[model samples]
Target: MKVESAIAQRISRDALISILLYVAPIALMFTTFYLTGYKPWQGSNELPFKAPGFLEDVFRNLSSWGLAAIVLGVGVIEFAVGLYENKWTKNERTLDIVCFVVPKLVVKPFVAYFGLQLMPYLLPAAKNIFEWVPFWWAFLIIAVADDLTQYWYHRIHHQLPWLWRFHRTHHSAPYMGMAMAGRQNIIYTIFFSQTYLTVALTYLGLGYAALFVKVVKSLITTGAHSSIPWDKPFYEIKWLNPIGWVLERLISTPATHYAHHADTADDGIGNYKGNFGNMFFVWDLIFGTGIITRKYPTSFGIKHYQEEEWYAQFLWPVFKSKKEGSELAANGPMVGDAVPETETVTLKQETANVAVA
Candidate 1:
């Protein structure tokens, strides 16, 4: 019995060490950022990066509609390729359109107005405190803070059963495209923590820089969700392998993001539990939640989904699923451990798949 106890202790120690290995990169990133005095939550003493007057004017004139145009253009290309013709179901289409329209037209404007109103009251003297930070520095700070906060928000929704319902609509589609990226519950969109963070940063006088960051972020995220696999050629060419490696690590590509939308991870290329990064894949890398395979998943979406009504999927809690036993059902258990059973089974099955690969 004593020998068995010692063996168990050794195993536990080894497991803990293994976990730390995965987490070390994330810890290092946070440490480096903090040490560099790039705190997004605090005011900086350095002068902000000055841009050419014309360039600043261009950014200042950019509107939210411009960002929408970029996303819409991508959607048009996807449609031209008939990407969604056969893949998207009626329910998926409804959820995607409703989720896409409602957030941009109503929820986001409401949230932004509320945030703008509440900011001065909450932090009256703190307004424009970060105006002294340089443009490049402020951009770096906003990019990281905005994306990192979103990474956690997305990861947490997947990790917790109750929160999973709020995000389920996103993964319900069996295929991915730019449209699928907007397929989220209304509550999820409205309560997105990063939105408020972005609003606060804008209030701190980083509005122009924040606008630029938002546009860049939108491009990265939309491209990542695209079915085009634009990064595929980079992975295939021997000469571009180094660039591909760096690119994949730096931002979300179709391969990594599709893994997050994969139906199951048993295939070795699918990792629905990880790769929660939106614009930046670095967060996933740092937090030990990323899986990189320069390869896309063969299948996407949650397994055994009962195809709940679009309304229930879009406006859940306000409109519960009528389907019995569904997570979004009126009387269903919210925080139950039942969901992980499938994940456990998938992991066990993945061992054989990995060996075969």
Candidate 2:
């Protein structure tokens, strides 16, 4: 329950809260949903009212229990990753909980709800999106579209300072594993601000396309942030690599994302929050902000990684920093000034990990 050095520096807490916060609810939810056969109320206005009754049946799924199971499983993986990781100087076990819980609990669901409510208005386009594709296509479209939305919003976090202030909470974790992926500002829910892509697709009238994309976002983003690293081998297979490389470039991958958390641009400019993409790396490549590293960070977090307090970390945009030199107060999300010059600071030999090997 106690983090060794974290107690000394007071940078991270010894509280075992993340283990409980991240795990307990997921475990309970999974148990409750699976044993009780409970599913979330899975739809809203996204279905085209004019569709053949069969089409309605095609997309209308009972509320889902699968997400609870999946989220809990990932939560366990994150906990296990934290226990096994011996390298963290900041003792970020507790921080991991905050990172995972805040965004996943407060943000992702709200965004999903907004997207769902929008389904009604978008039902017309939602129907059209599927005119050419089959049911399975619905899955792919959902996955791609959801990630696509995340890709741009995530990218904005790094490019703009105000957004980065919220995002910095995610990056500030000194150690990362699968759980780290969820670490972020709750206000990130705001990024779900309706987009042209969603609107366009909604108008296209895709059945359950919106719903499917929501499911995929939770899974893919969770996987990319996980310590699993299964993608490396998958990427090695010539066929798989192309798919992964293509998707990774097209959507955010751990390779690109973890690099964004890296301390050095020479290694790669990670913490500046610039290399943002969720499900696709291609967004970065297309936008000219991509960095592909074969290696991961020995250390994580911004060089001068400073946040005022936990309250400040959570209610960020509203809670102005009482301290100085924070990335937020100096300007805001859009300002690029928070990024610091690194020559003055040097990484410990061990701190700088293998980059792009």
Candidate 3:
């Protein structure tokens, strides 16, 4: 009993330290900005928010091309490392490539353009409401708001049967890598709430902060979905375990996020029902939807997955799967009806019988 109590107390101390490590950078940044007289709450109507010239310059110089370059560089590394086997089917490859290019080239630009245009007309008087916010504060606000929205968006799609079809394409891949991160449906990309939120923040004069947060968020999410277990070493090295502990709680690490894409929950490492965090794992931890084992799943992808065409996965309702019983097919299960009770019971029975046999 004494040993158990000591172990628990030690874990509590380590957890607190880890959280501090994750939060210290944000605290420092906010303090620095405040010392520099960055006050978001005290600005005149004529020159609301009055962003620092350096910040404006940084935002202006930020290039989407640079992001593309990073993606390509990471892709080269993933390929060179042979992270994927013969798992990249023709449909999978096509879907991933198209999803990757189309969003940047078409969807995001269209959304941002229209969002900027619509915001002024819809809320004309509220134009610079949050403009007076300090850059650091604005960045923190946008980061949390954007990430929380995405967390719910992702969680709902998994919890509710109807929305799963749209998200299924992402989990269809048998392997994990940088390419897999972009594998999403057209509707999913278009309806993504964060894109509009970002545009709104830009209009509110946090464009620079929003841009910086977006870059950091992208890196965290991309790293989470990659096949490489980059965080593995931190967990393995005894001295770095504290860093790993805090990191997995603060953001989506490979171990926690990979569990979400794992093929089956039967394996201890695969947790298909939880770990839905995209950029921030804290949501999952707070919402009782996270599981962390510091281990990798042996298999990835959906259970009983039907091989649907790339078009069906990408276009969805417009291009239903030809596979008769597939969830994305025309005559298949309705939204919210993917897993029937009878089917679940039968599955359990089969498992029980196998165990007995």
Candidate 4:
């Protein structure tokens, strides 16, 4: 009972902090508009700047085939560089490929099409209403709102035992690379508030700003999942340490994000329980959900991973895992038991030689 009470209190505290985090930026946005005498609802034909026609065309293409091209390109590069460390087994490959392809080719388009049809009835008066806002301000507003909302979405999934299965697919991969970046359950993708949020913003005339934010956020998140450790130099180089300090806190970096995927937190470098930032690490810092160590975790994925089938991971509750004790199995527990601390430490020590190579 005391443990449950403590858990309840912690959740309440997190909820309060999340509400404040969500509101602060929006409040500041309005305040900035008021102080600067910039009002989108009041209506103006003027914008701060107009993007070039060719550039607009490029962004449009990026919204479709272009984005897929970029992801595929990066995945190929990661493979060529052996970033998966020979851990991409046949089952892993099937899961990763399906998760990557299905979302882009099937799920997203279905949502966008249905969402467009539904928005007219749901928000009849809101289409293109805020079109007058300047491009830069719109970009800033969308970036903050989208990322923060996603931070909460992600954090809650980890906190709530029932929702863990929905997110389990993302954490099942034993390796980190571009392949695992888009690897997620179909239901998780369908209910991804970020997609709907962006769509609603675009409907309200922030389409232009949404385009830029989507591109930038995608690159940042994908890079963070890569095994490249691009942010390492920032921590290593003496003069750049100052820049690293800001960069790690300001946005998600490979080092910070990898910790979130670490198989165990026993090493102090691994922190699967926190670091819920997506595009911006600032949200984690603000809500006290992040941890940063310059070192990468020696291992990753769930300590109790049962190698559930791809269909089970991607379509759970609809299709259950056949693996007897898997979390996705029928009548399985909401969350799996963690590997014992002693076992985890021993496993890490044994894997150390392979991890360093």
lDDT of each: 0.72, 0.53, 0.74, 0.77
Top TM-score prediction, candidate number: 4
- For candidate 1, the per-residue lDDT at 103 reads 75
lDDT of 4 by residue, 110-217 (tens): 555556567778989987788877777678878887887788778877876788788989998998987788888888888887667656766676766775687799
Top candidate, metric lDDT = 4
Worst 10 residues of 1 by lDDT: 61-70
The 10-residue segment of model 3 with minimum total lDDT is 61-70
- Give the per-residue lDDT of model 1 (tens digit) for 1-357: 685476456545544654554455446656867798666545443225665766555434323232233234434553444335356678777777787667765665555556666788888998777666656656776777677668767876876566888888888888888777778888788888755666677677676567668768877888898878999988899999899999999999998999888887888998887898899998677657789987788887776577999999998989988898777888865632124465558877999799999
For model 3, how does the per-residue alpha-carbon lDDT over 1-357 read when each residue is reduced to its tens digit?
685476456546644654554475557756876799665467622222544665444344323232233334444554454335356877787877787767755677666666677778888877657666666666776787678778778877876666888888888888888777878889988898866776776666666667668778888998898888999998999999999999999999999989988987787888887898899999777767789999999888876578788899899989998997777888877533134455678999999999999
Question: Residue by residue across 243-305, what tens digits does model 2's lDDT show?
Answer: 776666655566666777676566544533456666656555554556776556666666665
| Candidates arranged by TM-score, highest first | 4, 3, 1, 2
After superposition, the stretches of candidate 1 with alpha carbons farther than 4 Å from their true spots are 1-86, 333-357
Report how far residue 54 has shifted in candidate 3, in Å. Answer: 13
> What's the number of clashes in each of the models?
4, 37, 2, 0
Between the candidate structures 3 and 4, which one is better when assessed by lDDT? 4
**Residue pairs that clash (backbone atoms under 3 angstroms), model 1:** 48-133, 48-134, 49-134, 49-135
Deviation of model 1 at 283, angstroms:
2.0
Q: Model 4, stretches more than 4 Å misplaced?
A: 38-86, 340-357
